[model samples]
Target: MSDQKPSPLSIGDFATWEPVLRLLWAGSEVHHAGRPARVAGRIGRRSWSLNLRTRLPSPGRAAQVEDIREEVDAVKRVRGALADAGVDDVSFTAEIQPSGEAVLRLLGPSPAVEPGIGTPYPGALILVDGSLPEPWRRLPDPVAGAVPAPSADLKLLERRLREGLPDAVGATEEEITAAEARLGITLPAELKVLYRVTRARWEDYNDDHEAAGRESAAVGCELFDLDALYIADASSRHCRWEFAAMEAVDTPPDAAVQGLVGSPGWIAFGDTGGGDRLAVDLTPGPRGHIGQVIMLSHEESIGAALVADSLTDLVLGRPSTRSSSARGQRPPATAWVTTASLKNVQAAAHPGLEALSIGVWDSAPLSLAPFTGLPRLRTLTAYPGTLADPLEITELPGLEFLQLGPQEWRVLLDARAVPRSLSAAAIVVHGNQDPLPVVALANEILALWDRPRIVQTVLEGAVGPGPGAQPGADRRSGGTPQ
Candidate 1:
């Protein structure tokens, strides 16, 4: 009988999980009908169902390739979740279609859901907070609806932008043609996708890092619009025109920059609200290393900083750190980890240590004590099964945000030693049909969150498929807690 007061979970991670779910549902929602499932402890068989109801376009509206990819990705996530749970006898069937009733049924030795709302079943839920609620569920942004999104071609590219972006729309074939005709140089396919399919502002909101509103991301960096794209020469792309108009700046050594590459012929497209922009190196094909995306900023001495080698890296976002035992580059701000061995991480800890994500998996327990060495770990994501000791969190004093996996969070909360200075927390729940316990936990967290300093909290998971209060915004941004 351990009757100790529980500490709170930390919800301060920067990357989010909305992209997967958004891509999956397209424009549908689940409507639960039966009594919710009961919470089973760390034992017994587990079953869950995702009963999704989608609204097909009225009349002649059509589905696109991104929709198909989203559907497939949804199935992959389901299967991956089951396998990650380490279930011995896993069996489930999914009939997710373009129309009609769509269900994701699972039976496992155990598994993941949407948060706060409760799990669609009695197992785990794989959802995250901090993102604007599904765009379709909220009121349309005044300007978001006004943005032009002409799409006659690039169905796959269009779908991707729509799934992940707030007000994504694609460029017409004519628009793409006109830009290339004006630039004179043949635009790379990936570069065309970057500017044509969506608004490429890549604006970095320096003053408003905490601005989490749906449309706030557009306020900063000046991405090249189609009209700008047509007129700009090699010397003055996007923000470069402004920079080029100024004076000559000193350059730094290559190793210091976060997202730049070698040579000086790169064409700038997007930028940080300040002096840096994401560029494509024209020096590649000539130098036998073409098509790489790097960072070029006037603020720092570092020039040609390497970002990801290609556009695919934007989605996967991994630095080529050579092979095992060698230190790969760390992201300047965040590192999204899906798979990596302990040794690989140990060697790769020097660069981007601000925000790190260790993707959830049902693997053997590992110690977090070692990661305390990550000097700049402001935010860290933890899986319950991965930690051998929850108290290892106490060693770090600078930690600001803590993201916790289901049962493991209970252990941390039970220990009651979470640093009061920790500003935010994210908790993933293994949902059961019963809503009372889940609601009680969220309520309790909300009540106590006002202490030490009001903590930013995000509650999401498949808690209940039906209607419920969704945590509104990341508290750090001054949004009210739901």
Candidate 2:
């Protein structure tokens, strides 16, 4: 065996004409020696494309035209393969150089390609680079199937701090204060720094970054040492902080708590792990008080129970205290409910709730009457299914948004009912009852309302005339015109 290694090939190697000379010498068989080809260009903020080329056999002049046609078909196959692999925004164009030579260019981002090493006489070789172009920005949010973002509540932080600080030194407040007065020295600056930061604006830290910031602050100040005076100051500040013990108590299950006049409120519920249930309490005050309660319980049923219980405490004023943060304390009047079963719509537990979304656990008929009495209900959504009864949706004077899939569309059409209060609606039809009548019905409706924008007509067969029929024959009746 020869004691020599092959030279490495980069992406630029294939761009040259020398590769063509080498392949011609090796019986016109060219094999890709580098990564698969890709388009490395961008079109707009979130759009990108790739570039690729391949060689074709130099058959004699008689078959040269056929050879080019076959290569074009091969390029189409490649495009189809990329599309099947979930790649999008693709295009193809080719350039034929002098001397019966050709370059096929494919446009798209880093698309998927198979890996192999083989030689075919008078065949093309592809080279690819996987790097994205400059000015490429990160995706604003994680991909749908990727990991989820971290969620947290700041009120929980304050509550945990208040509960943990009192027992840190195991001494009475007077004793602690007397000792601090006699020491003639202020406690560590770190504790005071944290207390001030947490008190100033806890909402500023209310996100995935909260735990990270807290950890950094604690470690920087060396607060873990039991003998340190930092813990003493934190405890002292806790005893004096006005809202330190402002526990979020239960309220009536159906009480309308005012929120900021123009601010948006959101409510979400489902089984997110841990024993904690998420309850958002928005109360109206000088500004706004948005308190979130995390009730810990391993069972989902228990979590819902805790949410119901907390709402009762919050509404009844059983455990009431104002927050020192001037943002105010008020109950959220608008609640959006997402549940595993539509039956749990009542679990919203908010009286005079303004908005609602009911996500079904499975395909089942939904009854709109049960929810019709809602005084403030504005929006309602459910999975695709038949309606239990003929419902005049217009009865709900406040209804605004309604979404229905194919099955629900059939139900509404069969009942001969139209939603008069609907300002916006989406109707999805799965299959045609009969293509011709459906088309005619759509055309009739469009003509009646003089609204061409709402109807889209797609005809499947030939446009001009039927097979083996005269130009003016009536295809539907199989007869010549009168």
* Best TM-score among the predictions, by candidate number: 1
Model 2 agreement with the true structure over 1-482: per-residue lDDT tens digits: 88533323211122221222222222222223322221112111123222223345666534454654533443334334444444433322222222223332222222121111120100001111221111111111111222111122235433444453332222344544553465443432222222433332223334545553443333221122112222111111111011111111223323222211111221222222332323333232222223322222333111112232132232222333323232224434333333343355455535455444544434455456656667756544444454455364655567544544445545555665645443333332333222223223332222322332212111111111224432212112111100
Q: Assess each prediction's global lDDT (C-alpha) against the native.
A: 0.40, 0.30
- Return the top candidate by lDDT: 1
Q: What's the distance in Å from true for residue 227, model 2?
A: 55
> How does model 1 score by TM-score?
0.33
Worst 10 residues of 1 by lDDT: 132-141
lDDT for 148 (candidate 2) = 10
lDDT of 1 by residue, 1-482 (tens): 98633222221211122223333334333312222222211111233223333446557768654545654454444444434444323322222233222232222221121222213222222122222111111121111112111221245544454455545454677877887676666666666766554644334333443432322243223456565643112223222111121112112222222122223335566565577666655543211234455665565422345555554344333443411111234333444444554333454355335655566555655566556756666666665465667788787666655656556666666777655645445554442233333433443343444421112233233211223422222222231322
lDDT score, candidate 1, position 330:
33
Model 2 whole-model lDDT (C-alpha atoms): 0.30
RMSD of 1: 20.9
